[model samples]
Target: MIGFIELIRASGFAADVRQVKLVRHKGDDLDMDQLRNEGWFETYQCFQSKPVFDGCTHIVSVIGEDATASRFVGIYEVQGSTTASPALLPEHCPYTQWGTESRVFYTLKKCPGFEDLEDRVVIDWGKGALAWHQWLTDRTIMEIRPRGRVLAPFRDFLRVHLSFEDLGNLATQPTAHKDWVAALSAVGGIYLIVDSMTGAQYVGSATGSGGIWQRWCDYAKTGHGGNLRLHELCREDIARARHFRFSILETFSRSLARDEAIRIESFFKQKLGTRVFGLNAN
Candidate 1:
């Protein structure tokens, strides 16, 4: 006989308690109806045999159907036990009466080549409860181990590697002058540029002082003549369009800020063509 612990809750009778059964086996078609009938009958027989103690009211079973299927097991029935009203031990409160409580009961079942079935049973129960019952299962079990050991570190590593790749690509771009301008703008610094009508090409930098917008306005007011590229492109039969707006894509933390800025400038230069500028350059 398997030594199993059944948890009984406080109710009208012992028959009101829920029964959970775990059957670990493979290739056997367990008839649900038969299990129910047999469980209830067994409870009745126990009640009849023991007049002093009332039988169980509920019975729940978790049976393993096939060994091959990933999840060959299932939880069945939260029924009552057959026992007298006002249980013998009133102080022994059940989980149901505690207003949404959970408990773990261990059963020592006798099965061939499966002495460790309890471990599997606990795992199944824990999973069914959506990991709320993890404490009940063995911590060392392979299936229930912490994800930090297997996946978390790898994910972080991947992210760092991808960021480096982005940085490397940025270093080769000439069109990224605008990105540097935007970065400078964020720090209250300015850049001056004359862009193609399409806003695709730019000549800009962060070395100059004062706000970029104000400086650009000053240049326009002084009649420095803007749109050198746009004018040249239009003369070549390229249709000129509106002035391009500069946008900041991202700001890096202080730790990586300098490197990220260089990367962005390089990436833009590579994408937009090499004719970008800074005050230090002629």
Candidate 2:
């Protein structure tokens, strides 16, 4: 991603100016209709350049281009504060002159007909030329180079072990899964309850009646558990930990919820080990 600052000069003292950034094509041979069809048409209009009598300043960011990504420009609006009434004196009413400074940035990507360039360039109106130049220079200095640890790449295909326990202390109901499901539904979504002290993790889903805390409490008392890998790991260390932190990483629509849950289980098994439960598919 790139960032830039822009300054615009507007007519009169109207603070309301629309900042439309656009890229102008250098070649006349290019077809405009084809470019428009690709959704690269200019979406904004530039303010009319006129004399200003009041002084006020506003800033904005703009991004757009033609068929070629290289032909893009970002814009900013700079407005001066002044009354449009003719009765005001130039000096006393204070006609303001507003000039804006804009900076632009770009990323690397394929362009069909153009030769690839090592660096993306920016063009802007000359006001704070030095400042804009410095901005670009600083960005170049801070560009990120990807490197370091590369994790096992095929984790998405793995199956995870998950475990569960009914902690309610009451007799296991005829609706074994449904009762706990009701309790968990109140909390909503999937959560990881981690016992930091024991390096243990618990992955579970809930809906409707019980919060995560209540579901865990039920698991603690009953010990009547499910045989998924994650649950067994947590159960092993249940005697050593008294506190755990619950983290909710994602929520899914009902249509995708089951698939998402399975995916989450696999992820934790590969990334977090045995503490997560409910992922066993085989």
Candidate 3:
């Protein structure tokens, strides 16, 4: 087993090392669904009996045994001893219950493998609520791990296809994978949206401005592209669209005329019987 300080140094927090503190970050269970959507947990505040805080940096470790192997979340640069709620809590954080005092607030920057971390990280106890280990040093730099998402290397971009979840990753943080989005937007193609829940399929074509990326960005944003059928289904419960899986059914030249793209789209719909028994309205 690696010592707390050594493992963190290896994780690339060494440059920003400060004296380790006994203080721990406290918070309620992180929202798993939101983590799935955003790819990382952010700025969790902690309350601890004021430990002797020096200019040392702290490593935030997940206290719950329920937390997965990537138990370490991120590093914290806590300069203050008083832990007050942020000027504004994270939009999703629930209101604090009665009789609680703010301790030390921690910025829980997520580690490299945050997604695979075991599902639960709920708050418990009092100042002892969240368990944390601190490291002390006076390094000037603390680079955030995996600064941004890299495009998946799958041999060919044209052959690229992903589930709704994968697309969500791209949409939620477009800057992280601008290359992937640009490639998709550059080409027009025949695509299919499969409803994983009912095995229904919708055949559609992308053309002109922004190409397939534009079309998919719409789905990522509203879970529907203003399509009469999808709009109705999503309106009923926006989450219903989670059942939607996206993939390329076929490909076409961006230079292909709009008429030809439409013809190909219609052909696939007929071949797949989508209009008759699927999500396609037309």
Candidate 4:
């Protein structure tokens, strides 16, 4: 089996394996979702509790779970470090209590030449995931996915479940997965949006011309989907939408009337107590 360090060396990013540390970032599903989807994982990693990467000249970063192969994120050149500030944390950061921990913020520069492998390359880091930070000599190359972890093909609508980040990804890259768009577009549906932060739910339905896809795209873009209560919440802090998770309550054929869709949505709202106990206003 070819080593991960060999591939990195061949790519011409780092000439010496001794100077590099292989780091795998794995956390709870919520943290992992934000890490992968929120676009701040690299910056977030800078706030370590200690100067763990102090002596390393460079670092190879991957994200995955313990006992599982990880996906390549990037290679970063270690520039230097400083004490972390409470204000430096992202607003929606999962690690809100980092202030309690004595953290060192390391300055890292993205190494060039390996941009093509981001999210496409996978590696095996042995079974010691608890030893997340390791010397480059200890890692192994597992697989290289040319498609770069494309979203799985659309399955059943009843089985449809998506995080807020998931919806944003699908909306932002509509052309990336035609089958998913096609599947969502094929039906008008009653859907549920749950604020994972507060357990509040918003029940809604889509019978628009473009079906569920169009309606959800609006929510992905605006975070409120034109609802009064959600608008109020997002107005206070837009990042709060990151706490939302979406799923289908029921699906309707395109032939369903708008009134019938609304009726179905009301049925779910009443059943789920969204109006009285959740985020729904009506």
* Tens digit per residue, CA lDDT, model 4, 1-29: 77776777678874466778888888754
RMSD of 2: 22.6
Best-to-worst lDDT order: 4, 3, 2, 1
Model 1 misplaced regions, further than 4 Å: 1-199, 218-228, 231-243, 249-267, 274-282
lDDT of 4 at 231: 93
- The number of the candidate with the highest TM-score is 4
**Winner of 1 and 3 under TM-score:** 3
TM-score of each: 0.20, 0.25, 0.50, 0.68
Q: What C-alpha lDDT does candidate 4 achieve relative to the native structure? A: 0.80
**Between 1 and 4, whose TM-score is larger?**
4
For 1-282, candidate 2 gives per-residue lDDT tens digits of 342222112112223332222223332543332223223322111212232211213232212122222222223333333322333213332122211212111211222221111112333322332221111211111211112111111111121111221122122332324433343344445556555345566556543334443545555553323535444554676543233333554444434455666676557655655433333323
- Which wins on TM-score, candidate 2 or candidate 4? 4
216: Cα error in model 1, Å: 3.0
Candidate 3 lDDT over 67-115, as tens digits, reads 2222233445555544445453455444342113544544333345334
TM-score of 2: 0.25
Candidate 3: worst 10 consecutive residues by lDDT?
137-146
